[model samples]
Target: MTVALASFSKEKLYPPAFDPGGLVYFGPMFDFVIGAAPDGSLSNETGALEAWEPNDDASEWTFTLRSGMKWHDGEDVTADDLVFTINEFASPDATCGGVCGALAANLASVEAVDEHTVKMTLKAPDVNIPAQFGPIEGSIMLLPQHHVEKVGWDGFESDPLGSGPWKFVSRELGQSISYEANDDYWNEGHQPKFKKLDVVLAPDQNTRVAMLKSGEADLIAISPDQVPVSQSDGFDILTVENTVFSEILFFKSSDPEELTHKLEFRKALALAIDMDEVIEAFYPEEAGKRTSGDAVPFSETTLGHDPDLEPYPYDPEEAKALLKEAGYDGSTIKIWTVTFPDGPEQKDVNEAIAGFWSKVGLKVEIVQSEFATLKEQIDKDGFDPAPGVAVTGFPTSNRPSVLTNMQSLMMSPDAGGSYRTYWDPKTADTLHAELAKIVDDATRDERLREINRELYEQYWSIPIAMKNTLYAAGDRIDGWEPISGISKVLSYETLRPTE
Candidate 1:
């Protein structure tokens, strides 16, 4: 009844093991022992985790395990599979991990206790341990030991065997991907109702929308400008807040004489832009509003979001004055935007932000690049010339216990996430000490908040409006809502046909 339209960049189906980004689609198909919903709510939203505990010390974690769960291959679920998978995935020789290196650091070992029980002991008492169990326990899909042991974890190329709701049917690179529902899925409580799903690799929005309108595709991610057409086409519109944002980058160290590090200069630009207008110009009704910090929008944890943290709202006059006080009359700024094909409002949004600086006497130059290009560029540039400004934000499990990530970003040369603020010894020592604390969750969260506050206060990057992570379902679809900052997009079982 409901047909959903989605676009993929390349038609290649790589092994999920080596492909971290590829997991985005495969995630909903597979299940994790832990996860988040689209709303930023926990799968066990009540804060009641049936499998693990948040209050426990990082040195020891107990997974109570779900009863009667089985892999897609009909292998009886056991604790040993989890232990085997964890050790294999987190091991250093391999892992398509964003956090596996760090998660692996704390994990001393993973061992099965009983048939449905596994325990993890850490090398130290970690305060931010719950962060490991991200929206889907912060790891990718749990691998089935039966298959991976034979194929080898890293060698399972193009063969994605999992205990997920959908099984891979066929794939044609740069063309299409088809999957069939798993009738034997153990977690039937959260399985998809659809018999089949197809993901066509069409990067152009015009092409995608055309396919949707022509009924060649049943559902498509509608652009704000195309919302009317979607409604006219009788497609259901779903919009929700997203943690993603874009920004102006400056490798200030490259030009120490530049105003990139000047607080007033940053504040002026922040105050000059009308983000609401940016939202309107690009996103219209489907636009998501931003919060004070880079925290996910519409989070349960964002209830106390400081309403007073005001953004500069198109006051070119205020912006001009701020720049003057900072001794910045006018200097050309090179701005870069990272975008993916078929992503939302990308060009208009980037252009709109650049326009704000231009209005207030700032010379702005824009550079745009594809996802892979951007990452490659960043890898090459690193801290040598930090992006004058770059837009980046990740989905959160609960407020992103960012200390672990922040510390790693700031300190680890290997990980080299943009925390590359070259430092005086005093500044370095102070920030490092704050990061190395071993404490309880309550204490750790407080420290983490302070770190986030400092990052914003220091004007590391301008906090643009939080965009909504959206998926368009047709009118024939029901029981779907764009959840808040909760992790994971949709439960496969939640997709019931409307008509």
Candidate 2:
């Protein structure tokens, strides 16, 4: 079977490091102790983990490895390997950086208790530790210590080893990758039913769709606009109201008196654009619902989302009034966005926003760049002297926990999370400190409410719409369905031939 992806060809087949940031390398190449189900629920699919428990202080966590587990090379999986991988990820010099740093931030030490038991001591208690380790967005995954130690990073990247359901057969850069079923895989029921698996890197969305139509590929990722068309051709369509969002991020102003710094200015900008129209233009109705606050609509199902709150009305007149009251001349404010595929035309959507903002007596400048370059620029010097708003998207947590939502979506930038609108280092830390002390579920709910309200009240960043991710597959694919959450790895083991 062949699968087509909209993503570009990866330069490296596997990560060269043993860290959480490098977990993407492990996803296709290795197995982890725990993984996320299609709906984003954590599960011990491979039985790598028998059980786990946290100590009384909540600072120490102990995990018991499933006995008799073997690596692809037939080496016994032991507690020592787990300990080594964790410590390596925690190390500051890890090659895979940002996420690696975030994953190991609170780690104090990791020790092997015995041949089957491992202990981790954290500097601070974190309730969402499991999610951090789970295979949600390629965070925590295990590696074979023996193979990596002997072969080293360079050799390991070229020739990776793992006990996953599929073993890598060959990879042709800018072409395709092939794999075969891992017959010796511990979990027999979940093993790949198909004799072979192949993935092609078709970056073009139309090309992917065409390939699917031509029977060149069995499965492919499609944009919302392409969903109905694919369905019309008798292909199966899976739409998940994912925890993904398209939002406008505000950067701090070089001058405190600038329009970007004013709460009224931000509010006016929010009021000026019609999100409903935007949604209709860019996404299918099945793709997602409009969001009221900084969070996506799926977040409303969580603890803190206020049901009574309403999205800002599209009122250009009010926007003009607010801008006038804030003493803003018709000065041009720059906005930026990047090119992306398997989604709406971001450039056109951004231009629409600029047009709406313009109607309210604001001059607009639109700057465009590639996603990678723009991301680098934003990370290094967030609007530095060249202050402007940048357009971007964030994938939300599929977990039903408030901690998961906050940590992944709106936690402060200093906390290694991406809530950079207000750009305060101390805000998130203070809130998290308060949250850590509250043990009552009801009390935590109230606290989360307060936090959610505060974020909305500030209007630092405005969420435009919640995005729905759609997947299309031919009838030959089975056991696959549309899931509305952030599970990066679809359990390929569950996928099989329908015929």
Candidate 3:
């Protein structure tokens, strides 16, 4: 059995509606209806489930589940789980807005027609329906409705019930939580190899690092800074390139022709980013390497991987000259960053961008706030996109909320589609409509792939380097491979103890 150890802070666990930071302790205790595969393919890459066909464009999606699966609770996991999950996320009453709400805004209704069948009808066609099934995104691992519906949304989260390889055993406020294997788990025949698992909240990086070093902890999510010294610490390293992209988002609420929308400015900003140095500063030579692709490379669909969009040549002078030509002697640009959990890399990225703009003759002012503060500032009617450079993504559709949310809905949570820059609604709508007209999945993927090109070619917003997620897992663990964000870090059931 695996004896993996992790440092986690559980200020809360949930009905999962409100807890974006989910059962940080019992993550493996749930299963998704459909999953994103390691290669970024949605809907079963693990030899688990087969692709089900869609009946019609009523936007109703039908999934025929693999048979014989049951909840860890020994109760049958029926179509109801899938139906409940879909309705929960689509309902404004849902606590979790996991990224599905925006993409599936056209969802009209959902129903589990039978024990093994689930059907979802949309207000409009959404090609990204399958990608939204995970707990990380909006569609969640099914909750034991008997328990949740009985307790209601508020109470159900505290004592959530689910069917997984493990069961929720005990939780101790802020310190740690533990889970024991479900002896009667439905997948008992599949043979989940571990007997028990435990997660503890160790908020301090140094403390977490020490816990791992001393064998008190077996895994820790790494920061770019911790990777360097972590190299010689005698642990095997696993790198998972993530699908999330962090960029210098531009709101451009005031600048109409968006002179700042120049490719030169985006290119200059891209060029000015010294990612390698920043990576080196935070990660060991072995862990730090430059990565590309508009989003994580794998998710870019072959068409999105445009060589023309490569990282800018690192030349501050060239950048300055470009700005000069644009008549930008460096007007004030607002720089927003998360302060409470400031890692060296996040801080460095902000400072570098600010200083680079300054060198280019722009006045730079730094604004440090937590993710919430920045989000609040950003969601406002007049939020300036140019001022914030938050790391965000539309993992479900590979579309940028920074683009959609701002454009159509004026930054309202209910915005239809657009980025914070609110680049162009008519254009995005046209592109999406064009893709919908194409019936084949391959052709549709190709159509979706053009988002990056349009973002850069049309100067919708600034594009930054796509990143790889680096999680520190001890070599003693096996099979729970870090497959990017393509699924919840492989199923913990696969993790077998090693000596």
For each of the candidates, give the backbone clash count.
Answer: 30, 0, 26
Question: Candidate 3 has what TM-score?
Answer: 0.82
- For model 1, the stretches where C-alpha displacement exceeds 4 angstroms are 1-21, 44-49, 54-57, 93-97, 136-139, 153-155, 243-258, 290-304, 324-331, 341-343, 381-453, 481-483, 486-488
Residues 171-202, model 2: lDDT tens digits: 77767767788887777776787878887777
Global Cα RMSD, each model: 4.3, 3.2, 4.4
Clashes of 1: 30
Ranking, lDDT, top scorer first = 2, 1, 3
Candidate 2 — what's its lDDT? 0.65
lDDT of all predictions: 0.54, 0.65, 0.52
lDDT of 3 by residue, 405-432 (tens): 2223223344453334534545556554
TM-score of each prediction:
0.82, 0.88, 0.82
